[model samples]
Target: MEVAKILHMVGGVGETSYALNSTLQKKAMHIAKPIVQQSISQLYCKLQPTESLTIADLGCSCGPTTFITISEIMDEIYEVCHRLSCQVPELTFFLNDLPGNDFNSIFKYLPTYDKMVKKEKGSKYAPYYVVGVPGSFYGRLLPEESIHFVHSSYSLHWLSQVPRGLEDDSGAPVNRGNIYIDDTSPPAVIKSYVAQFKQDFSTFLSLRSKEIVSGGQMVITSLGRSDVDPLGGEVNCLYGLLAKALNSLVSEGVVDKEKVDAFDLPLYAPAIEEVKELVQNEGSFEFYQAKVFELNWDPFDDQMDDFVADSFVSGENAMKTIRAVMEPMLANHFGGAVMDALFSRYAMNVAEHLKKEKTKYVNFTVALTKRG
Candidate 1:
């Protein structure tokens, strides 16, 4: 249930959610659809004529984009089936998210799909059925050896929770900021996160190995940073801006600064090397293809045609929309008491950033594979 709840928190109609809904979804889809198609082609190439292909949309937040991803997969399947003279395999789609996700919203979109399937009855397009599995992907959410393809977008980096000991003062001394970055991270924070990723990925591979059958394929893509950042480091820029706003509230006596800093923002951005290490250790999946792609995806980036589209209109309205979008996250991240103050800080910063820093280079990563 916490997983589901967190999905809603991340996907619900708020600043973070709105950004996902408005900008991030569009950017992710542009890259994800094509890569998924490529992965499907690769999978089909290694498949036997008698084997049926299956697909899954993992970490699918609540939105039509999920359907779009599924649609692309189906289209790819359709094309491959036609070319290879292979019959459309019975398609079983597992739409997975946390227990607190907006399943109802996601489910509502399924009937239209079912209706389309009915209209095409007796056709060879393949029968596709979608069912919601509410649980965490860090563990096995599907029956072993039952899936043909697995895909998750912009979702893998978030750990179940912040790494431990980053905030604790029980030992030598205490500090603020992310624990994994602290100079005194108990010597285990990084290892712990990496270990968890290894374990989670191992379970993913082991379960997928069973579900995928031999020769099946899986494609996963999400945000990843460079192994080495010559600059300060890889920071979740949006999250950092958010943190700054929250901290500003605390400094202004509008919220508790200590609590704001203490609250861990659940996220992780591993490098390509880390990804390689995880996959190499698992050994269940063969290294098919891997690459770090620079995606021009962030809406807030300078490439936007309308950074301040409403210059002619009152600045008050623009600020209002921004506040509407960010308030919920501030409230959820900090608390209602200081939510307004936090948003105010964010608004001031955004106004200043619009006038100063504005540029256009947001990057992402893509990884493709086949069942080894």
Candidate 2:
């Protein structure tokens, strides 16, 4: 299957759409906002472009927060200029994602978005334009030195493709009956995933290096693991349960076991040091700040307890979150017939697990400044 062509969140604003179910992603963005603001503020003061400031949001999937992000960025720029007592610059924003992303869903709300902005910014507002760019970030999509600030949130953990070498000399998959890494996975499986991440991330930095001007700033946030073991992170537990759900369907004769064995997620949540090392090796940017943090699987839950109070509701919420981000790819591979049954079992499994012990998603965020 062509992963790029199929790799988009469940589109439209239906009950199951990413627009409604992206609270966890929104939470992560909030956590990273300070870093984003700091980087942009420093860059603006330094360049102080007379005419305009250009910004890009890579992997800018469509949702409520999609436009909210642009609004916030412009608001930040306006606030800083107000304090500095200087002329506010016009702005251009590029929203970039793969071709299959719900760009139309994003475009639908543009008129209302502009009207709201005009009412809010009446006199002090500077004009801004939005353009959608469709392509892979693993390769070049923009011209040289055209971008001044770049912000990517809850992206970059996705590898360009599934890791190779999960199969053996006989062309049999070594990590069978699993969609992702687990405790029983061989050394080959772990090595294949790590190596793929290194290659893809380096390519990403090298491409962005050409597009961003000297002295530009970037803030990137993605799923990450704090554990030294690549296979022992929060993501493993999340996908491992998903594997269990699929295997149950196989046992019930609803899904083919071979299909389960053949599928693997094209994602990796790396250790924080891995990211820092690549930024240094890529030779394009300096890390102003690098940090790791965690959030509950239930986005609305803020309790400090290791055990959740309402496991059933949290389980349901968690399933919606995962379904929004993963349904398209799963349905494409496994056939849409099994989606509803699969996630029903998944929601129950999650509720039982939550009752036992609460699990959180680990994340890493970095603020960067480009070198001359």
lDDT of 1 by residue, 26-85 (tens): 566666666778887777666646456667777776766677777787778778888988
Worst 10-residue lDDT window, candidate 1: 310-319
Candidate 2 Cα misplacement greater than 4 A, ranges: none
22-96 in candidate 2: lDDT tens per residue?
999998888888888888788888977567999999999998878867987998898889888988899999999
Clashes of each: 13, 0
Number of colliding residue pairs in model 2: 0
Model 1 spans > 4 angstroms off: 1-22, 48-51, 115-124, 169-203, 227-234, 296-333, 337-341, 347-364, 368-371
